[model samples]
Structure formats: C-alpha cells, structure tokens
Target: MNLFGKFATVGGATLLSRVFGFGREMMMASALGVGPVADAFNLAFRFPNLFRRLFAEGAFNAAFIPLFARSLESDGEGGAKRFASEIFSTLFVVLTTLTVLAMIFMPTLVRTIIAPGLAVCVDTVDTGRQAISCETRFDLTVTLSRIMFPYLACMSLMAMVSGILNAFRRFFAAAVAPTLLNIILIAVLLYAHWVGADTVTIGHLMSWGVLAAGVSQLALVVAAMRLAGFSVALGVPRWTQNLKRLLILAGPAALIGGITQINLFVGQAIASFKPGAVSILQYADRPYQLPLGMVGVAIGVVLLPELARALKAGHLREAQHTQNRSLEFALFLTLPAAVALFLIPEPIIRVIYERGAFDPTATPAVASVLGLYALGLPAFVLIKVFSPGFFAREDTKTPMRATLVSAVANTVLSFVLFQFYAEQGIALATTLAGWLNAGLLFLGLWRRGLWEIDRALVKRGALVLLASLAMGALLLVELHLLSDWLVPAAGLHRQLAALAFLVASAMAVYFACTVLFGAVDRSMLMKLAKGRRGRAKAAE
Candidate 1:
C-alpha cells in the first residue's frame, strides 16, 4: 500500500477506537458525573497512563522504530527478531520494576504528584455543600492508583510489540489494539450503570477494567506478531550495546515524546485545586482527541517508519516528500476540526456529556476549556507531523530541548493562569505551550536543513486555512439555526440529530471548499483510488 493507504488503515482503526471512547466517556459522565469519585478515578487512571505514555508508547517507540527498521534492513529477519526479543526482555524487566515501585509508593505519588490538592482539600472547611469528604477522595485515588499501576507493565510490553509490527508494515493489529481499552471500559461502565453501582464502586470497577484492557491489548498484538511470522522470545534481560544506545536516545526522547502528556499532567495538577476541574478538562479533551488521534497519531505512526526507511535508503527526496505530505495531511484534517470545536464546543459537550450526574451548570465552563484546547488542536497535530522528521533521523535531543522549553512555559503559565481563570486558564496555558513547541520543532528542522516547506505544501497549507475559516463561518450559522435543538432543555435525540447534522454539514462544506479551491490534488487522490482498485483486482 501507499502512504495515504497506510494512514487510512491506522486512522480508520483509531476513529473506531475514538468513537468507542466517546461512548465510554458519555457513560462515565452519566454514572459518575463530576463527583469526588469521578475526580479520583480520572486522576488514578491518568497516573498509570502518564507513565505508559512517557516510558512506553512515546519514548520507547520514538527510539525503537528507527533502530528496529535498521535491524530489519541490515541484520535480516533472524537478527531483527533477536534484537526485538532482547529489547522486549529488557522492557519487561524495567516496566515491571517501575510498576512495583510506583505501587509501593502510591500514597506519595498521589500526595505529591498525582493530586496533591486532595490533601489540601481535606483541611479546608467546605463553605458549600460537600458531596464526599476530601479525605475519601485522597484515599480513593491512592487505592485506585495501586490497583491500576500494573497496567503500566502490560501496555509498555504492548508498545514494544507494536513497534515491531509497525516496522514490518503490519499496521492494523497494533493500531486496533487500543480499541480494546475503550471497549472493555465501555462494557464495565455499562455493567456498572445496569447494576446501579455507586460512584466509588464504578471507579474501582473501571480501574480493574483498565488493567484487563491492558492485558487484552497486549495479547492482541502478540497474536498479530505470531500471525505475521514473527516472534520474540521471553528470556533473561541482557544489557547489550544496543540497550545502551536505546537508553541514550530514549532518555531524551522520553521527555520530548511525552511533552503532550507532561503538559496535560501539569494542567491536571493545577486543575486539582478546584473540585471537578480534572474531570471537566478530561471531558473537554475527548472531542478534540478524536481528531488528534485520527489525524495526528495516525500520521505520526506511519510517517516515522516511512521517513526512516526513505532516509535509510539514502532517498533524501523521498524523505522530504513523506514529511511534506504528512504535514499537508495533518493540517488539512486538523484545521477544520479545530474550527468546529472552537465554534460549537457547548453543543458538542452538551450532546456528549450533559445527562445524569453531569450538571447542566458546568456546561459553559467545559465548553470554554474545550474552545481553548481547540485553538491548540492544529499545533498539537503539527508537533506530531514535525517530530517524526527528527526521530526518523535518530535525533531525539533537539526535540527534547524544545519540549523542555515548552514544558517549563506550560508549568509556569498553568500555575499563574489557574490562580486567575481556574480550568480555562490552565487550558489556555497548554495551548500556548503547544504552539511554542510546534514552532520550535518546525524552525529546528528548517534551520538544520532537515526539512523545508515545498511549494505544494505552502499552497495547500494556505488553502486548508482558508477552507477551515469558511467551514467555521458556516458552522456558526448552523449553530444559530439549530439553537433550539441544541439547547440543554432539548431532548437527547434532538440534540444528537442536530449535532450530527452540524457535523455532516461542516464536513461537506469543508470538502467542497477544499476541492473547489484546489487545496487537495485531485490527481493524487485518483492515484490512491486506482491503487486500491488494483489491490482489489490482485486479491481477486
């Protein structure tokens, strides 16, 4: 398949997963609302997920895929498998050790890092109605963190397996494995709601569900690995020269790769000072993540391997083409989505998460946060597009420096902003930090002669922006037209229909505008379609 074909393979699966994720979050909002248990659960889940991203999916994959591709090219399948097994054993040991330590120190992690505000909230006299004691929230977070910490081990191993699959160009299983997490959690939430479980019970069950999903996801990719005629043996961990080199690359990549997570962590920490702020941010996050996951994550996954192979073969022109196309693809999809999110956050949030325990009063606050996050959506995807340019060349330190600068800016801004604007301020800080990071990454590549904006990309980029603005204008008009159906007082079905119509209209308008304005190359799209038809004929 071609690059766009590969992107579709991964992005389509991610779209499925994100759709399921929306279901999961909607259920959580109904069952748990923005209560103390919901807050605790969100924090506990993020704790393990933070580590998973930092150590496994983010840093490990950034450093691993290029080297793994190199192994496959230079060392043959046997040598590549051996290399994978060695790396797998080492990853298994390291993550296991980290999980144990994290579980043991759960309270400290919660008190100091995860949600220190819980401790402080316990001492503050509630001048308002108290749904649950702050003490309970603190203890619940610690308990849930310990219960789910083992998920880190499972997912980290899964990441290594996924890297192996991506290197081999078998993208589907690795891409689809994440859906299990959402599917499992959705099932758990359904059960919890059906049984009429309390918030605390639901939180505990969800934690266990997370652990189960991790195992299921790992099993899936491992099975895929075997089916692909590849296997990694589990043996004693060995410290080889490759391991040392991996550490050197991953050490910096960890921070650089996890910059987005780190920024979220900072926001979570600061948002913790206010009740329900974490869950609010998380709710706002889900809508924007759909586009980011579909476009940014998919492109990043496919682009890195494609770029690495191109550069490895000394095909500099091919590498440049891959980078430019990836950037064009990212902006084309992301800009319009960002526009929609920014323009209609309230309606989106209301439709997705406004029933049951979720108070209608919180809708505006969540919408505001969502809008600020939307402004940074394109920046977030741009980071994904550009970072692979460096990673494919095995340079992690440059992005790491940019990430550190962004991280510091986010931390300082979040701290100052949270004091003033609360959750929205934190959201704003993250957005600014993302743009800063994306700008620096882009500049680094351009200055180092690693990447340049070709004329096609520049032309398409301008058109994409123009089309996005046109879509935004139409969306605002749609919102006005559908105001009656989108209101909080409207029935769920009406709201759903209205939001669906809005989305359909927005997509239609954006596509029409892009095509009319020549933002996309019709000939390239035709080539992709022809390739698909040829593949189908071959299969027949």
Candidate 2:
C-alpha cells in the first residue's frame, strides 16, 4: 500500500467532516451562545469523546490492528475475518454493559468530572470580604450534562464498528463517521430555529441530536465495513488470543495515549469554576481540531495498518520510512496551520462565532485560547504519527508513562495559570502539556533508537518553518491593513467575506512559498495527494 494515498482519501473525507463540523458549531454558537447552554453542551460532549479517545481511538486501535494484520498475514483471509468477528462480539457486549452503567450513574459522573463547576452552582462561596452565590452556574451544568450523557452509549457502538472497519484497512467509513455527528447537530439546530424555538428548547433538541448522531455514525461505518468485504457477526463470544492481545495493548495505550482527552477533562473541571469558561474553551478548540483531525490524525490512522503489515513481514526499513514520511507530512502541514491559528485567531473566531448569542466579547477570549493551542499543534499532530511505531511493535507501556507525565503537567499548569488568566489558563496548560507530550515521545523514540532525523529532513523542516514564518508575517500585515474591515460593526455577510479573503490570502502565501522554493517536492506532493494507499504506484 502506498501510505500517502490512503491518507488523502481518508483525510479528504475527514476534511469534509471538519467543514460540516464548522457549520454545526456555527449553528451551535448562534443558538446556544457562550453561556450556560454552551457550557453545559460542551461539558456533556467532552467526556464521551474523552473515553472514546482513551479506549477506542488510540489505545484500542494500537493493539487491535497489529493483531488483525498478523491474522491476515499468518492465518490468511479466513483467520482475519474470524479475529474481527470475535472482537466485534466481545466489544459489543462489554461496551453495552459499561454504557448502561454509565447512563444509570451519569449524574454522579457529571458531578465528578466537573466538580468545581457544579460546586459553584450547588454551593456558596465564602471570602473574608465577600460571599457569592453560584447556584445558577452549577444547576445549569448538571442539567445540561444529564440531557447529553447518553451520547456515550451511541458513540461506543460506533467506536466498536469503527475499530472493526479500520482493522480491515477500510478507513473511509470510520474516518467519515464523525462528520455525521456534525451534520446531525447542524440539522437539529436549524430545525429548532426554523420552528422559532427558544435557547433552552434548542439546547434540548441538540442533546437528542447528539444521540442520533452516534447511531447514524455507527450505521454509516457498519455499512462501509460490509462494502469493504467484512461483516461482524453479533453473538455470544469467548476471549481469543487476538482479543487478549487487544486488551493488553489497549490497557496501556488507553492510559498513555489518553493524555490529550484527560487534559481536556481537567481543563473543564477547572473551567467549571467560572461561568462560560468551558464554552469559550470549546469554541477555541474547534478550529484547532480541523488540522489535527483532518491531516495529523488521518496520516496516523492510515499509517498504523501499513506499519503493522510491514513489521509483520519483517520489513523494518519500510516501517521506518513510513514513520519518517508520516512525521514530515504531519509537521509540514501542521506547522503552517499553527502559524495561521496563532496569527489570525481573533478574526477567525469573530467571523465564525461572533453573532446572535455569541458576542464580540467572546472573540478575543476564544482567540486567546486558540493561540495557546497553536503553540502545541505540531506536537499534538506528532503524537498521533509517532505513537503508532510503539503500538505496531506492541509496546504501549512507554507512551502511557508519557501520558501520565503530560497529564500531571497539564493539571499543575491549569491551576497555576487559572490563578489569574482563568479559562485561557486552562487552555495554556493543555498547550504546554501537548508540547511536553511531544518532547517525551521524541525522546523515548530516540532512546530506543526508533527515530532519527536525516539532515535533509532537518533542512527541509527548517525551510518550511521559515516559509511559514514569512506567511505569518504576511498575514499579520494584511490583517492590520484590514483590521477595520475584519472587526467591523456589520452583518454576517460582510464578516464572512473578510474571513474568506483572510483564509485565501494565507493559503496563497503558504502554498505559494512551499511550491516556489521546491520545499515540497513533486514526488512528495504526489504521495500526499495520493494518500497512504499508493494506487499511484500501480497507476504508474
């Protein structure tokens, strides 16, 4: 398989999902605003995603794929199919039991996850000088969380199907599943407005939308898996060797690779102390995810199975090359995206989010968090790309250590920053932890002699950095020139037009310089354009 080709198809689909996500969030911002409804929805939405990332996306995939690859390589097609069927049967029952427990005890879970925020509304705060009531904020969060917590059950089923589909090296269905969530939310929000619903009603409708999204996503991937020459038979099951291997891998991978989600959980816990903190963080985090999910994660997902296949065949060199290429691509694209986020967050936020209930006050606040997140974007993407090396080797223990350290770093930083910066402080903590996570991963890889940087790669990376810096400078200048145009007292049409101009200009500068300087060579471009599955080679 040509690694790059697969990423393109999968990444392109993921990009469409992100675009739909932007639309969904846009509607969310307008309908719910950055107040109680927004905070409640964000708090409710994040935990399931937290577990999804922890259990299903990273750790589970890390363990499952190599085993599935082995089944395919050693035991043939029949063996691989049997392995997948057992995994499906086992995961379905386990996740169903867990979800039922979670749903039944969701209120306690909500309070535990956002204890500080809930405490504010549920308790009275005392100071020597003053006392304040926090009942409104606390009650709002608890109420919102209750409405949306069932999303976990839906996503778990989807995540299992996602894993099975991905194990078959069919990424399109799984990669595209998330877009449905975005689409469903958008549809719900629009429907609420069409019928002239109030904010509370809209929030309630959107909560149901979340559950519906999970079902839609699960169905989409299950169908895609069937089309890709796989069918998961649901039934009573026993734990096979493949299942055991998955548990062993997923357990450590979950602890290690779940740092990012855990960091968000901690941040939300802190944000719960202040009104609207969670909501602002969610808005800022959305734009950041666009690049991370579409490109960074797409590359990682596509490369995992490829790396496993190569390793099973004792093709270490191919595996190494694959890792190198994956890092380069992730860094090259993510660096520019980081630059864009850091350089122009305010305008981007204003254009997309500053309307209806989302006021101008929210723009700089959300933008500030987005800027901090940009500092770690490259590291965040690199984590996805590099961890597969350890995962494909069935080494999940190393990343787990790094995950804990990063999580601790994030927690400490959140408290330290929140002393004054408030919600942005929590975001900064996460940003710093991401950098820490990336640094530790690179160090571990080097210690094991698993990663090395070629001088050519170093030279090219430097050039990309310089080119992106130049692009950032250009964007800053343009933004200043059009500051009047961008941050204006106007309708949505005018604001959106300026945003379009800004994005186009940034794209022009970044791509133009990369191509002009031959920093992105044609072959590399062709490979990226083709994705990880190299039908390009076959075509040639």
Candidate 3:
C-alpha cells in the first residue's frame, strides 16, 4: 500500500470511531443533559484525557517512533525488540507511579487544575435556583476523576505499542483501537438509558465504562502486536543509554504536549465558570473533531513514521514529497468540512444533539462555538502535517518553542475575551491559538530548509479552497431550500433526512467543483485506486 493508501486505512477507521463517538455524545446528552452531572462527568473525563494526550499520544509517539524506526533500520528486529522492551518497562513503571500519585491527590487536582470554578462555586453562597449543590458537583468530579485516572496508564502503554506498530507500517489495528472506547461507552450509555437511571448513576456507570474501554483498547492493540510477531516483554526497569536518550528527547516533546494541554485546560477552566459551558463546548467540538481526527490524526500517525524512515535512509526528496502530499491531502478534506461547519453549524448541531434533555437554548451557543472552531480547523490539521517535519528529524524543541508561544497567547486571549464573549470567546481564543501554532510550525520548517510548498501544491491548494467555498455557497442555498424539513418542528427523522441530503449535496457539489476546477489530479487518484484494488485482489 502507498502513503495515501495507508492514510485512508487509518482515516477510514478513524471516521468509524468518530461516528461512534457522535453516537456516544448524543446518548450522553440525552442521559445527562447540560446539567451538573454532565459538567462534572465531562470535566472528569477531560482530566485523564488531557494527560493521555500530553504523555502518550503527544510526547511518547513523537519521541518513540523515529528512534524505533531508526532501530529497525540500523539494528534489525532483534535490537529493535530489545529497545521496545526497555522503553516499555520504563514507561510502565513511570506511568503506574504517576497514576497512583494522581489518584491520591485527586481532590487537589480537581480544585486546582481540573475545575477551579467548581471549587469557587462550592464556596460561594448560592443566590439563585440550583439543581445540584456546587459542593456535590465538585465531589462528583473528584470521584469520577479518580475512577478514570488509571485510564492514563492503560492508554500510555497502548500508545507505546501503537508507536511500535506504526514503525512497522501496520496502521489498521492502532487506528481501529479507539473505536473500542466509543463502543464500550455507547453500550454502557445504552444500558443506563434503557434502565432509566438517574444522571448520577449514569455518570458513575460511564466513568467505569471509560476505564474498561481503556483496558479493552490496550488489549486489542497488544494483541495486534503479538499477531504481527512483535512482542515487548516488560522486565525490570533499566536506565540504558537509549532509555536516557529517549527521555531527553521526550522531555521537550512532553513540554510541548503539556503546553498544548494547558491551552485546553485554561479554556476548560474558564468555561467551567459558566454553567453548562464545558458541556456546550464539548458538544460543538465533536463536529470539528470528525474532520480533524480523520485527516489530521491519520496524517500525523502515518506521516511521522514514513518521514522518519525516509530521512533516516537519506531520502530527503522523498521526505519532502511526503510532507507536501500530506499537507495537500489534509487541506483538501479539512477545508470543506470547516466551510460547512462555519456555514451551517446550527442545523448540524440541531440534527445531532438537540434531542432528549438537550435544551434548545444550548443549540445556539454550541453552534456559535462550532462556527468559530471551524475557522481554525485547517490550521489545526496543518499543525499535524507540519509538526512531523520536525519530529521525524528528531527536532522536538522547535515545536516545543512554537507551542509555548501559542500557549501563552491562548491563555492571555482566553482571559481577556472570556469576560465579554463567554464560551465563544474561549473558542475564538483556541482557534487563534491553533493558527498561531500552525504558522510557527510551518515557518520553522521553511526557515530551516526542511519543507516548502511546490507550485503544484500551491495551485491545487488554492483550487481546493475555491471548491470548498463554492460548496459552502451551494450549501447555503440548499439549506434554505430544505429549511422547512430541516426545522426543529419538522421532527427528528425529517430533520435528519434533510441534513443528510444537504451533506450529500454539498459533497457532490464540492467534488464536482474540484474536478471541474482541476483542483485534484485525476490521474494520481486513479493510480492510487488501481493500486488499492490490485493489492486487495492479491490478498484474496
């Protein structure tokens, strides 16, 4: 399989996971609503997820994959296996210790980092109607965070295994592993909803489900490793030179990840000050995350190892071509999704989440945030494309510096804007931060002579943007034409049908415009498709 083929494999799997994630979110909105329980649960979930992103997905993958791939090239399978086992043992020890410490200090974490707003609410004398006491919410968040903190350990180890798999060019199992998370949560939500459980019971059940999903996801990926004839046995931890070197590289990358998470944490903390804002932002995030995950994540996961191997083999031109193609492909899909989200977030939000206990009032807020988030979608994906330029070369500090600047800007912007625009301000701050991060990463790559946009990429990119705008224009008219069926009074099925039609029409118009405007290279796409088919036939 080719690079884009590998991207499709990962992206297709990611799309499935994102769809299931949407289902899980919809069920969650119905089960908990944008209430105290919802706020608490979302905040708690974000806690472990924040660290998982910081340590495992962010720093670990960035640092591990290049070294692992180099080991494979220089030392063969035997040496690579030893390296993997050494890293695995060391990671296991550190993560286990961190998880225990986090659980032990869960209350402090909740009060300080997770949701200080909840702590403030707990202290304030309520002067308004309160469904649940602030103290109760704070306690619930702490408990839930403790229940799910172990998920970090599970996911961190899973990420190590995933890095190994990606180094081996086996993308499917790792890409598909996330689906187990959504699948497990959906099942738990379904059961809870069927039994008509209260929000508190549902919250507890869901937290447990998250931990279970973490374990299940790890198991699936490890099983994939074994089947691929790649197994790392965890022995006593060692401080080998390679382990020391891995930590040295991962340290800066970890800071970069931490900086990124701090941006998010700041936004979440400020949003927590407003009732239901955290849940509302989360609802809006799901829409944009679909494209980001499918394109950005797939590109990041596939591009890094590919670039690492190419650069290691002194194939500089191949590395540059890979980067260009990855960027072009990312924008081609991401631009249209961003345009749609910006143009018609209300209807999309309504169709997906404006059911059950999800209030109609929250739809406008979610839509507003989603639209702002849409503005940064391309930049977010670009970061994925450009960061690998540095990471694949074992240059982690450059992105770290870039992220630090963005993080500081985001923190300041969120603080200044939140007082006026509320959650929308936070969203705008995040978007601006994303663009800043992307810009810095790109500039770093260009100035360092590591990357450049060839004319073909630039021409095709402008055409893709043009095509996306055309689709957005057509979508506006389509939405107006279908407004009758798309309205809330039209009922769920009618609204759903109308939304689906609009999406399908938008897709048709966009691809048609891309072809008509010569935005995509038809011959290359054809070749890729033919290659895929040939490979399938051979396997059969």
Best model per lDDT: 1
The residue-by-residue lDDT of candidate 3 on 1-540, one tens digit each, is: 788888899999999999999999999887776777888888999877876666544467889887887788789999999999999998899989998998999999898888988877844322123457888889899999999999988988998898888778888898888899899999999998789887888889999999999999899999999999989988999889889889878877766645545666789888888878888888888888899889877887888888887887899999989999998899889999999999999999998888788888888999999999999989888887888788887888899899989988998999899999999999999999989999998999999899977988999999999999899999988878888997789999998898889899999999999988989989987897888799899999
**Which regions in candidate 3 have their CA more than 4 angstroms from the true location?**
55-59, 122-130, 255-262, 532-540
What is the clash count of model 3?
A: 0
Alpha carbon lDDT at 209, candidate 1? 97
Per-candidate TM-score against the hidden true structure: 0.96, 0.91, 0.96
Say which candidate scores most in TM-score: 1
Candidate 1 TM-score, true structure as reference: 0.96
Clashes of 2: 17
Stretches of candidate 2 exceeding 4 Å from the true structure: 122-147, 237-240, 526-540
141-229: candidate 2 lDDT, tens digit per residue: 55666666656666655666676678766777777778888888888887888998876567678877877777777778778877887
Q: What is the Å distance of residue 111 in model 3 from its true position? A: 0.4
Q: For model 2, what is the error of residue 9's alpha carbon versus the real structure, in angstroms, after optimal superposition?
A: 1.1
Better of 1 and 2 by lDDT: 1
RMSD list, candidates in order: 2.0, 4.2, 2.3
lDDT of 1 at 427: 94
Which wins on TM-score, candidate 1 or candidate 2? 1
